[model samples]
Target: MFESLKKKFSRTSEKLEEELIEEAEAEDNLQEESGSRFSFFSFGRKTDEKKEEEVVEEEENLLPEAEEIEEVPEAEEVEEIPEVEDEEIEEEPKEEKKSRFWHRNKDKDEPAEEAEDEEIEEEPKEEKKSRFWSRNKDKDEDEEDVSADGEAKGGIFSFVREKTIQEKHVEDILFELEMELLQGDVAMEVATEVVENVKENLVGKKIKRSNDITEYTYYALKDAVEEIISIPGKSMTEMIEEKKAQGEPLVVMFVGINGTGKTTTIGKLANYYLKKGYTPVIAASDTFRAGAIEQVTYHADNVGVKIIKHQKGSDPAAVAYDAVEHARAQGKELVLIDTAGRMQTNTNLMDEMKKIKRVSNPDLVIFVGDAITGNDATEQARKFNDAIDIDGVILTKADADSKGGASLSIGYVIQKPIMFLGVGQGYDDIMEYDPEWMLNQLFSEDEEIVENEA
Candidate 1:
């Protein structure tokens, strides 16, 4: 039934999710750009430092070779070569004599040479093993350092990290939703409250994934609506039972503006109670309006319930009192007082309605409103509640109301529960108001299934 309102809520959630995701993506892109720039500059600086170190090492190696060349003797020392030659000539004969002895022991020296070669190979093998072990240890240590650093710095996967919802992210979206609600015939106060509640629920929350944005938004909107509709009060059936236990009828007074289906609502209520096995007496107290008494009487007869009615121009308060007396005498469980439909500005009619309340001392005062009237119904309910404290609300023609502004705003405006919804023209068309049902209608994807289940 609430097609327009449902669409508004759905759009708001989607828009908010989109806005937040966009902002998160923008921030991540900025971070990536800044990170890339920093890495590029650092790499260039490290390359320059390595080149300078290599140049210094080349100059040091050339200095040592030049010093060794300068230390060698020149050709001017030729005379000293004669003494060196005589020493070489005398050592040659000694070398020839020893050569014969060396030739004989060469076979024995071959074993030693083989052993020396084996030792040389073994030394390289040990060195290679140590180098491999050292390289592996260094690699493992580097890996550990990288992991520790990743944990502390959010790592390369920082772009996918959870985003915390900020005020700026939702401020514009919530404002838009508030304006849309107002345009949809929602009361300004109700719209403002919904926005504030949603903002409070969403801000500072962490969204771990893209899907979490939608989930969070849905719950935030649902919770705000739930709070607005959940007015604390006893239901009519409970009141009836309470009074019934005390051997008295539960008196209920109905008030509303003109042509909002007040009489028909009363008739429907009469039939509803009659079917419930409760002996209900209807009070035709709407004597100001022409045919009001007759209309109520017709319903009373049709529903097979007793009706206490007066002639035209009779005191409505007196009629209500008579009906309550009748219910008490007959041991009826309910007294439904139907009052004249009057505008909130009609002082005379308002005073008269108040008199009916004083005389009847109703256990509950209900404001019946037309759901199609939207904000007008909400305003009327507020005025009536200010005039007389209404215990609850009943919205008529709810099935025909596509906007559903009144159903959403009336109870919240008056701080009263919407006890029932008048869905159709038949006597059994009314159903008790359920907040969960309203939520399902607004948020469920399968509206037809939800309606059927409801």
Candidate 2:
């Protein structure tokens, strides 16, 4: 199925595994560093204590000099007593001001110097012990919390082996996945959505301690792929049969650029309906291109269905209108209209396609694209859908496409279901699209390795 896509995704998975391993090792290193930081912090506290002791000694030495300065003179003591009493009264307000300053700025200038000195000498031991214990305690709590994220608080050798996918790690993996998708020719919008979906599934998710990181990654990626390809209630065959059951012929119009196997897919579709017992009529409305009528005619003959056509360069809208009327008149169950192949950038051709769509009002407007076209096929489908409002897609040459970008992204980009895939040149090679089947193919490692070896 998606062998090429499988390889691409496998490479991405390998990269993810490598990154996870690196992150686990880094976590182990971080834990070790935390222990070393604890030791350093303890040694630093002792050094700070020693410095505090030296500062205390310096303060004590300065005390005697300070007292000498206070010995103003005993002779003047009596005369200064009355002045001292006045000074004391006046100095009370100054002391009050110094007290306020000390509180405001924790100053040690005057009024609170003794108190500040006493506090300084006594507080460091308690402060250091408290700080040291609290820091290590918080570190322990953080390690415990880190364990909750995916890795348990393991011993030095065990942490690296017990890595888990964290939110941060998921972001890194998504970035890498996006790059890989782009490289694999997945469209930017599709790639972005895929990664976003993966992120939503992975972020904040706590894996069981016994679970491997790769298991979570695999689920996230599988969910993402399934999401990208899924379009609920948009099955083309069901819609076609619904219209048929409503007593109307199911008219399906195919549109895409040249060489996308539009005609071949039309033949395959007719064969598909024929086997289901639905009478089909092929409409050769692609009159603009040389030999387009002959091509559809050959397919009609090969599929054993009647074909309607006009000469070269006939109005395609008229052809579609006539074909639908023919199918209705003949009581046919299906009408597969093959339109001319033209580049999506060609405005005249796009307008022509839109006119055909308006005229026929097909039950399903299918955009046929080459799966081998890679990213360009997605853009082609988008433009075609914009012009004609395509109901679904039928990818051709899928087996030849090693990258499988178009198959993976066309539906996501255009918001349409991929109805079928043309696996090979044989008319019977086509098959219905199944998202689950595709995902299974993508995630299959054995198949991927075998295909890669080939």
Candidate 3:
């Protein structure tokens, strides 16, 4: 039932329904005054026998037996306002030739002056009718479809406004949003938070619109993401500077399950240091993936950073030893040792990753996780953090995940600052993380989340 209600929000349909209901109620009210005549049947009344027969047929079918129509004789000076006459009203303008009553004599077309007086007197009533109909043609604006203090849904079905929204429509919009989020495989909590916040922002305002709603939604999402990544954790540069200032070369290690892009991130990290005027030396410590050594070597050569490698199937610790000696001799500022992307599920591999850390003695141990794997990334972070101390997280392929739930929730789960992001598959795919900008984009729609929470 909840899901069913969610897909029914149609802005065009809302407007159309409001107009229709008002029209129906107005028609019913007018019919009450006219006695048994639908407003539509008011025009084209005729005294002709054929017309009388047709009216009788319609009256028989529609008129309720509980109410009987009785017509009192018209008073000489007082009578209900004559109904609008389609043909007669138009002919009434030419009152100078009053042949309205045909007596089969010349007196039929004789008096035009009296007819003119009657027409003049009826003019004001006609003007009043015209004004009333014109004014009532539009739906009532005072019905109060949506209000912040009111119920989600109210007196009217599918009611909403630029200021307030119907409860059903809110459900509809939020449900659709939730499905989209889940289909993108966002974390369940992430999806729930988005739906909850979106509803809070959407109600008491016109969503499915541009203006404030669109901007509000974007900002709301941006803010949530920003909050997630905006941990007051230290950065790679800060860590490196702290280490170097204390007369210690910063050693950083990367860890994750196989095929999680751990080694690629290591190359990128090495590339980052080389550009920072810090000659970074990399260790091909990942012996699992066949192309791991060559991958680091390729990026290492391309970045003008040398990598320490050994023959395939060689012990990873051996390469780490050579890499550390090389960095120490060159007086390098940072040592980024790429460890095997081994599954933490395998106890032996987890032990190896731990042993490698002891051998390398890295200052920062970052777990490179895939953003597309959703909560699995969180579990991987936890597992790696348990196996070996994880200091921070480096989320790769961030832009690839559309829902972006992983990027947002990972920081909270892991309790670490996301140092960098891999946006695309370029050599310069890595970029400095922007917590504030990301938060703003996500929570841009939420004034409360962006301003009040700040």
Writing each residue's lDDT as its tens digit, candidate 3 over 223-322 gives 4444445688777888878877876778888888778777777777777777777878888888767887888888788777878899888988878878
TM-score of each predicted structure versus truth: 0.69, 0.67, 0.56
Better of 1 and 2 by lDDT: 1
Question: What is the TM-score ranking, best to worst?
Answer: 1, 2, 3
lDDT tens digits, residue span 357-376, model 1: 99899998999999999999
| Cα-based RMSD of candidate 2 | 25.5
Top-scoring candidate (lDDT): 1
Ranking by lDDT: 1, 2, 3
Query: Where is model 1 poorest over a 10-residue stretch in terms of lDDT?
Result: 33-42
| Candidate 3 vs. true structure, TM-score | 0.56
Cα lDDT of model 2 by residue, 1-454, tens digit: 5555665554554455456545665656322312211110122234446879999999999799778876776556867577668877997899899889778765444556777788888886454334432322444343432321222222212242444456676666678778877888899988898888877876665432212344555567777888888875466567667877787888888888888888989998889888988899988999988888998899889889998898898888888888889988888988888898899889988888888888999888888888887898998888888777888888888878777788889888888888899988888889998887676566644423322222
For all candidates in order, the CA lDDT equals 0.77, 0.72, 0.61
Task: Quote the positional error of residue 315 for candidate 3 in Å.
Answer: 3.4
Clash count per candidate = 0, 0, 23
Instruction: Please tell me which predicted candidate would have the highest TM-score against the true structure.
Output: 1
